[model samples]
Target: MKDKFEEAKPILTTLMAAGHQAFFVGGAVRDYLLGRESGDVDIATSARPEQVQALFQKVIPVGIEHGTVMVRHCGESYEVTTFRVEGEYSDFRHPDHVSFTSSIEEDLSRRDFTINAIAMDVEGGIVDPYHGQQDLRQQVLNTVRDASQRFLEDPLRMMRAARFVSQLGFRLSPNTKEALTTSRELLKEIAVERIAVEMEKLIAGRYVQEGVELLVESGLVHELPIFRNRNNLVPVLESVTSRPLQDMASFLSLLVHYSTIDVKTFMTEWKLSKATKNKAHTLLDGLERLSCDPLPYVLYRVGEELLDSFRELMDSVGYDQLHPKTSVGKLFKELPIKSRADLAVDGKDIKELFPDEKPGPWIQNLLNDIEYHVLLGQLQNDRNTIREWVIEWNPHDPS
Candidate 1:
């Protein structure tokens, strides 16, 4: 499949054909130069948002005041933003006022980083006003114009700086690095949710250790939600191996494992989703159980759906050393039943086997016993075999 830029070329072509200057700007242009897969193709143009809406049949005024609209074309949506300059960042998140400009160069100046300040036209020409291409060549990440001013405008840029280190494996310029130390406290003004986004991406990047080091050195970690008080736990982030984590859930699991913090508190402080919280809980629980329980039993508890993620969590936390001879995958495959649902007999079936016994927690307990035996391959999953086994077993007898 063609990349996002190629797919959205017609939109650029159409905008230019309307006698307006337009170019593929921001991360899309940066990633294109880096030879990486860019996520979204954003168009920066001299045409105002109204002009853009007028030209495109399918236009969505998602952020019109900010000079942005979603242009639907060829089954893909591209954010077409007008070239503009901001007034003041009183909130440090959004610009207080914006004035549309015809110059892409002026618009590029307002961007956060030098690498993202470059622009590309439809015919593949670059507009590098601040020598972004040079920075890209040097593999150095720095802010546009003044580092302090740019960061003051938006503190999250500091987090993004460390994140870019992990993503691009680049070193921060001395000036940029110094600015991060001085302006790290501004990160407190940013929402935890936004900070969480960058933190997650930073840990998930290939150079996670480098990113964590930046976080520690820059003092940005001290500004984060939980890491602010737990300075000792911050270095623990460097313990993660070279292999990047699959996602935020794995990193959260790693944090909980090392710090032994309550999963619910972590979830609430970080403002994570319910699904993520539950996954972290499962991974943590699996690690605890794997230490004592048999491989098959632990696999059953972790469940098949989360087996791979659980294994990733295990590797991230260095739990793999405990099971040097064990192959979770191999053992899981050899199990007679993967889950309780796969058991031949249900609670109703077990209750029927013992009609005189009152229907209570005993049925679930008996199923657990059967499920364990079935998972260990000691008992067949066949219905008749399990029924006969249940008949011979005495639930009331301790023996």
Candidate 2:
């Protein structure tokens, strides 16, 4: 079969004709060599960013300062970056400066790992200056150059190396592993958002157990204030191998495993958005309740979004597959209260019966009672009967 390169050939030819050396580069080349479908096609060229912009009518200067541009062709956008050597990384993230160079070898040398450093020229063929092909064939993760220097230049690359191990099911070379363990402290200089994104990918990977084990072994897990109780994560990692996680929230719940302090502290320390924090809390709550007999009230309280998350959580922990007979599965099928909108009566209907009563706490209390009744399956969901019960309902009367 003709690979994804067929779709990108025309663009490569166009740039080549313009007196620029264009070739498919980065993860695309790695994936192609590994017999996997490439997710995105990245092109590297000898031409500067401005030259690329001039060649394409609809060029987007997405990272122009860094000699990168997005060229639109055939209704698709392809990232085209000029081969460049980076300067010292003062921030341990972005380089202090970047200089476009003509030598592709120089550009490849600056990359984080040998596997990711390989590039392929469309006509000239693969460029393996660092023997990345050998490393790939060996199924090992090795650094392109000095591991400490490379990781110190950008600490996130250390985590990324581990992530690639998890993602590609590869083993880290001894030297590479040592470098990661030594460089674990450098992660403190990286941003939370970058750390969170890598963590999510690492946990979601097929070999998450390996990646997480590496993190803990390298002492990177304890560096994060939220992961101080790293021991709790062992069971969580064991759980994730069974079921694929639906989203980050479910993954977070598994990582924390019902630890109230860890969850709250991690969320706050990571500066997670309020929406994400709430979702993570909901997943944890559901998982905690499901650890025992799955209860209808628990399902009603957790809602459908969380119920789905709970199923994923169970699967991640290597529990029995969530079949229809499972308590969670059954509760999912028979959620008596689908939504607040499913309540039998509304405020307006209650108002009509008790015209003298103002819409206040009592009205909300009656709705809550009706919702509880619907959830318990005690009463048929009818507006007339619900309204009658609301009229006579007295909070003060215990009987």
Write one digit per residue (lDDT tens) for candidate 2, span 48-161. Answer: 988888888899999999998998887888999999999999988778999999988998988888988888877638989999999899999999889889999999988898
What is the TM-score (0 to 1) of candidate 2?
A: 0.86
> Cα miss at 17, model 1 (Å)?
1.0
Candidate 1 per-residue lDDT over residues 1-399, each given as its tens digit: 236777888888888899999999989889889998887888999999989999989999999999999999987888999999999999999999999999999999999999999999887899999999999999999899999999999999999999999999999999999999999999989999999999889987888888888988888889987777987876666675356887677877777777767777778888989989888888778888866777788888888888888878777666678666767788888788877778888989988877777788878888888888888778899999989888787444433
Give, for candidate 2, the lowest lDDT window spanning 10 residues: 390-399
User: lDDT values of the candidates?
Assistant: 0.86, 0.78
Write down the TM-score of every candidate. 0.94, 0.86
Q: Write down the lDDT that model 2 would get.
A: 0.78
lDDT of 1: 0.86
Candidate 1 C-alpha error for residue 397, in Å: 4.3
lDDT (Cα, 0-100) at 76 in candidate 2:
84
Best by lDDT: 1
